[model samples]
Target: MGLQVNIIKKLPGFELRVDFKADNDILGFLGASGSGKSMTLSCIAGIVTPDSGKIILNGRVLFDSENKINIPVRERKVGFLFQNYALFPNMTVEQNIGFGLLKSISKVERIDKIKKKILDLQLNGMEKRYPYQLSGGQQQRVALARALVVDPEILLLDEPFSALDEHLRNSMILQLKDDLMGFKGTSIFVTHNMEEAYQLCNNIIIIAGGSIDAIGFKDAIFNSPPTLCAAKLTGCKNISKAKKIESNIIEAIDWGCKITFNYEVEDSIADIGIRAHYLEIMVDDEDVNTFNCWVVFTSETLFRTKVYLKFSEPIGDEKDFDILWDTSKEEWDLVKDKPLPLKIRINPEKVIQINRN
Candidate 1:
C-alpha cells in the first residue's frame, strides 16, 4: 500500500539521509540541483545502494543493509523514467516500447501491448523511427511508454518533462496524470521546479544539502513551511532575521522594520518571510505593519516587475537592498506614477515565521 524509506548514503560533501513513508500517491522529491534527489531515486530503483538503513516497498524488503537483503534492479519492480530518457540508440520506437514486456507472454500479446502503448503515447506513425532520428520530446515519450508497458509495481520519474517545450510539456503532463490516475502503485517524481512539483504531486518532500528539510501534503507544505530552508525552497523571496519583541510582533533585523502578525509570535522565531507578491504598494501607510520604503531599484520583465524597497535607514552597504515586491506590469505602471518614499504594507496573515535563520 505504500513505500517506506529510511536510508543513509554518504556523498562527497554530506550524508544523504532521509526517512519518509508515501502511500499509493504521487509524491514529489523537490530540491535544488545536486541535492540528492536523483541519488535517492537511484537507491529506491536499486541502481544505487545506501550505506545503511532499509528501503521497503509494499511490505517487501528492497534494501536492508542489516539483513543483507538488496534486491536486484530488475527484481525490484520499479519503472524508472531517467532524466536522459535512456532510449536504445539502435532500437526502433516500437521495439523500445516492447523491450520490457515479459517473455512468458505470447508473441501476439506482447505485440498487442506494444501497439497499445505506442498509440496511447501518440507514437502511431513513428513506430519504426530510431532514437537518433527522433526529437528530444519524442524520445522522452518513447522511454516513458517503455517504462509503462511493463506495468511495474512502482514508478520513479526524474524530471520527466525537462526536455520538452512548454506546450508539449503541458500536454505530456496531462498524459502522465492520466497514466498515474489509473496506476495503483506508489510513484515518486523528482523535480527541482516548484511549479511542476505543485502541479503533479499530492505530497512533497523538500530536500536540501542531501537532508530532508520537510515532508507533508503539498497544500499544507506550501501554505506553511516550518523551516527556513523549506520556506526559501517554496519561493519565499523576502526573508530577514527576526527577534520576537512582543506577543504578536517581531523585529525584522535585516530589513530594518517591525512586523506584526495575527498569530502569537514564538520565542524560536529566528527568521520571518513574506512572498514578494504578498507585498502591497500603498499610497499611504496603515496604522499597523506599514512603513515608508525607498526604492533601491526595479527589474522589469515582459509580464512583471520586481521592485526592491528599503524599509529602514540605509545600512551604508553595497548589498543593502531590503524587501522585494513583485507585481504585474500593469500594476507597476499604476504604482510608478506615485511619489518617492512610497508606503508599503505587510499583510500580517501572509507572513511566514521560520524557526531557523
Candidate 2:
C-alpha cells in the first residue's frame, strides 16, 4: 500500500505545509532542526492535529480536517519509532512488545506474537530485561519489535538512530535495513543526515523553513538539487548569486566568475552551486572556467582534505567569500608540495543551476 499526505499546521514561528505521496518504498524526510519534519510525522500518526487537509494511508483516511474526522492515535495503526526509543521503564522487553496486543488478543496469541517478534528482532535471550538494562542497540531492536508486533499499516521513524553512538548507529542501520526487507507496509524515515537519507531512502522530500523545498528520487535530488536550500541540504558546498549573462552563460557574482553551460540556461536561475568534489585542479591557466584562487586555509578529515580558497577579486565588502574544495588524501598528497597560489577548474557539467525565489 501507499501513503498520501497534504496537510497544514500552524506553529509558533512557522507554518507547516507539506504535500507528498509515497508507496511501499522507504521515503526520507530530510531537513534541518526546526524545519517541521517531526511535526508532519506527528500529524500522520495522529499524535498532533493539523489545521487543514487530508492524510490517507492505503486508501484509509487517517485525518481529514474538512470532514472533521481525525482518527484516534491508538486506532491509526501506525508504528511510530521515536528518537529516544520510548520504552516503558518498568516493563520488560516482552511486556513492552506485547503491550499493544493485550487488549484484543488472547494470552496464547499474544505470547506467540511476542515470541515471533523477539526472534525476528534477535532479542530472544533478553526478553526479561528492562529498557535501562539493555544496550542502545538492543533497546532499539526492542522498540522496533514493539512497533511492528501490532501489525501496523505504516511505519514512521523519527531520527531513530540519533541517540546511539556512531559505531552503534552504523551497526543498527545495517540491522534495520535488513529488517525492513520483510516489512510489507510503507515506511517514512525522518533525519537531517544526507548520507543516511541517501543510503536508506528510495525517494526523498527535502524540507526547509517549514515547507517542502524539493522532492524527488534519491539520485536525482542529490545530483541536481532544484533550489538553493536543497543544494545546501544535499551537501553542496559552493553556492553564489548568479545572473544570466546569455542563453548559455551565467555570472557568479560572489566568486567573481562567469560560467558557461552546455545546456540551455533558464532565465529563472537565481543561484549557482557546485559540489566541492566536482572541482578539479587546473594544470594550465588556459582552461575554461579556471580561476586562480588564494589558498585561505586547509583542514583534514578522516579520508579527505578540505582546502578553502578565496577569489582573486573581492565581491563588495565580503572578504571571506571562500569556496571549499575537497580532495582525497592521495590527491592532496600529490599537490601538497605544490606552490601557494593554485588554479582550479569547475566542471561545467557539475555546475548546478538553482531556482530559489
Candidate 3:
C-alpha cells in the first residue's frame, strides 16, 4: 500500500511545508540538521501534530486537519525507528521485539513470534541479553524488529545509524537495506548524508529551508538538480552564480571562468553545479573549458583526496577557493610533488544548470 502526505507544521522559528506520495518505495528525506527532516517524520508517525495537513496511509486517514480526524499514535499503524535506537535498557531483546504485539495475542503465540524474529534478524544467541550488552548494530536490529512486529502500514526511520562508528555505519547501511527489502509497506529513511541516502533509497526528497526543494528518482535528482539548494544537498561541491553570456556560453561567477556548453543555455538557469568527481585533470590549459588553477591545498580521505583549487585570476574569495576536484589517492600521490598551476577541465555535458525554481 502507498502513503500520501501534504502537511504544514509551524514551529517557533521554522515552518515545514512538504507534500509527496510514496508508492511503497524507500523514500529518502535528505537534508541538513534543523531542516525539518525529523519533524516531518514525527508528524507522519502521529508523534507530533501538524497545524494543518492530511496524512493518509494505506488508504486510511491517519490525520486530516479539516476533518478534525487525528488518529492516535497506537492506532495509526506506523513504525518509527528513532535516531538513538531507543531500545529498552530494562527489557531483554526478545521482550523488546515482542513488546509491540497486540495485547490480545496468546502468550505462546507471542513467544513464537519473537523467536521467529530473533532467527530472522540473527539475534538468536543474544535473545536474553539486555540493550547495554548488545553492539550498536545488534541494538539497531532489535529496534527494527520491535518496530516491524506490529505490522505497520508505513515505516519511518530518522537517521538510524547516526550513533554508530564509521565501519559500523557502512555495514549497518547494508543491513538496513536488506531488512527493508522484506518490508511490504512504504519506508521512509531520513539522513543528512547524500551517499547514504542514495545507497539506501530508491527515491529521494531533498529538504531545504523547511520545504521540499526537489523530489524524484535518486539518479534524476543527482544528475540534474532543479534549484541551488537541491544541488548542494545532493553533494554537488562546485556551484557558482552564473551569467548567461550567449546561447551556448555562461560565465561561472564564483569560479571566474567562462564555459561554452554544447546545448543552448536557458534564461531560467541562475546557477551551475558540477560534481567534484566529474572534473578532469588536464595536461595543458589550452583545451576548451580548461583553465590554469592553483592547487590551494588537499584533504585526504581513506582512499580519495579532495583537492581545493582556485583560478589563476581572482574572481571569487581570495582566502577560500570555490572549486573542488576529487581524485583518487593513487593519482594524488603521483602529483603531490609537482609544482603549482595545475591544469583542470570541466566537461560541458557534465555541467548541471540550476534553475531559479
Each prediction's number of clashing residue pairs: 0, 0, 0
CA lDDT, every prediction? 0.88, 0.90, 0.90
Q: Which pairs clash in model 2?
A: none
TM for candidate 1 is 0.94
Model 3 over residues 1-357: C-alpha lDDT tens digits? 599999999999999999999988899999999999999999999989999989999889999999999999989998889999888789999999988788998999898888888887888899899999999999999999998888888999999989999899999999989988889999999999998999999999999888998899999988988778888888898999998989999999988899998778898778998999999887787778998888766799989999998887444555578699999999888777777777788999999997665
The estimated TM-scores of all candidates read 0.94, 0.95, 0.95
Model 3 Cα shift for residue 258 (angstroms): 0.4
Candidate 1 residue-wise lDDT, 1-357, digit = tens? 689999999978778998999999899999999999999999999999999999999999999999999999888888989888988898999999988777899999999999988888888999989999997778887998898888788899999888788888887788788767877899999998888899999999999998899989999888888888888888999989999999988999998888877778788889889999999876677558878987778899879999988875555555467899999999888878687787889988898888743
Candidate 1: RMSD to truth: 2.0
Weakest 10 consecutive residues, lDDT, candidate 3?
A: 313-322
Off by over 4 Å in 3: 313-318
Model 2 Cα lDDT, one tens digit per residue, 260-289: 778778898898889999988977879768
